[model samples]
Target: MDDIKAMSFETAMKELEAVVGKLEKGDVPLEESIGLYERGAALRAHCDDKLRAAEEKVAKIALGPDGQPSGLTPVDGL
Candidate 1:
């Protein structure tokens, strides 16, 4: 949980999974569980933001009539 903003989507996702696993086992102390839950929420939000950015980029890909990616078009409001 060191500078989560600097973590890549993959790294954040992996950490989030670990946090969820610990929480699901129901064995962690209350204080630790709360910390883990908060971190998991932050990680989930970061992942969502990354995915949304990816979707926006994908939307800008222009396809030719032959159904192949021709180029990237300028996305509105991007």
Candidate 2:
């Protein structure tokens, strides 16, 4: 199995999509299908985590006293 933790979000999502397509076809053997399903679940979780982290970063934007956009605030616990 590939090191899923090292995979970028885009790469993990693409792999997860391919896994879904294969599973949908119902052509793989039972054992292989099980493995693929497990990997897909992991990828899905990883993607979700990455998205949540990104959202947190986006949420930390700072504004000036005039209400204009300034910059991002320091994201704690990164």
Candidate 3:
């Protein structure tokens, strides 16, 4: 779980994709398949959290004078 907490978005996505591939292959035993399913669920949650955080940052952004939003700013008190 700590490893998952430390995983980056790309890393999580890659692992999730690999898990899908393994599941699709249908060669894993029932027990291993269950374990992989749980791991995939955790990875999905982590990826979703990262996406939500990014979306919140996007939503807080203010448009600049040039009519384009400025780059992400650190959330106050974060």
Query: Using lDDT as the measure, which candidate wins?
Result: 1
lDDT of 3 by residue, 1-78 (tens): 779989999999999999999999999999999999999999999999999888888877877889899766666656
Mark the regions of model 3 whose C-alpha exceeds 4 Å error after superposition. 70-78
* Model 2 lDDT tens row, 1-75: 458888999999999999999999999999999999999999999999899988998878899999987998977
Candidate 1 vs 3: which has more TM-score: 1
Q: RMSD to native for every prediction?
A: 1.6, 2.3, 3.1
TM-score of each candidate structure, all chains considered together: 0.87, 0.83, 0.84
Indicate whether candidate 1 or candidate 2 has the larger TM-score. Answer: 1
Measured by TM-score, the strongest candidate is 1
Lowest lDDT 10-residue stretch of candidate 3: 69-78
Clashes of each: 0, 0, 0
Better of 2 and 3 by TM-score: 3
Candidate lDDT values, in order: 0.94, 0.92, 0.92
lDDT of 1 by residue, 1-78 (tens): 567888899999999999999999999999999999999999999899899999999999999999999999988997
Instruction: Rate residue 69 of model 2 by lDDT.
Output: 75
